[model samples]
Target: MKELSTLCYIEKDGKYLMLHRTVKGNDVNRDKWIGVGGHFEKNESPEECLLREVKEETGYTLTSWQYRGIVTFVYGEDTIEYMFLFTADGFEGTQISCDEGELEWVEKAAIYDLNLWEGDKIFLRLLEENHPFFSLKLVYDTDDVLQYAALDGKRLWL
Candidate 1:
């Protein structure tokens, strides 16, 4: 199966908004900390998907954001997800309860301490460093352990 999605890290005061995936029982990301965003609806552009997903999940309309990267996630042999990654610095709205999980503004450095997927650590670090727009591919086994990783067409680990 193949999927297209958007994910964004909204930043303010040296922190990023993060979601703790604790609400869904069958979620692939259960107990994991991740950014806000979701799959694209038919007829939606990446920007439209980003805006809609972020608004739905976080109750904030992004006023300023950057297309940071693209992450191709390969889960074993059957499932692949192409994710549009974004970073937003400006937004306005009152926060609300998210049905998907609890939302928290975590310190940038502290995010590394969260329960995140290994591949997420890689891309999160790239975002923190303000790296140039990139393409990252991450492959994982059934156990969810990262098996391979590449950055911008250069193999980094395996």
Candidate 2:
């Protein structure tokens, strides 16, 4: 299992900083507007991963962030990714476009308009509600359909 982590940076104005990626490789979330982050290196914690990834991709030094949720990524027969999701509200420095994609500040009210994965949509909504969500384990079947999901051992917010 490959452990991956990501961070969602929210500005004081209720706008979220996101990355627009192109589908030129085998990345599962390629060609999507998603958070800026990557896999964790050895001996690095989730916080370290988010801070480093944000700085590397957007040239920002992150400060305030909260652990929002976790997701299990199932890709084909030989790949499984354990992902940790985080939300940040403060950072320093200017944003810059990275080789991964362009960077943009998206309003909180308009996040649903972007091309996001179904799982992302769910937790993004949860984050907006200011609720405390511990974890969400989603299972994607062979056909890529989210056949089952156990959220905090109960049904997720409907």
- Top of the candidates by TM-score: 1
Local accuracy by lDDT, each model: 0.96, 0.77
TM-score of each: 0.98, 0.88
lDDT of 2 by residue, 86-153 (tens): 88888989877688888888998988899887777777777888768567767676666665566777
Clashing pairs in 2: none
The numbered model that scores best in lDDT is: 1
Q: What TM-score does model 1 achieve against the real structure?
A: 0.98
Worst 10 residues of 1 by lDDT: 149-158
lDDT of model 1 at position 120:
97
Model 2 ranges off by over 4 Å: 155-158
RMSD of 1: 0.7
Clashing pairs in 1: none
Clashes of each: 0, 0
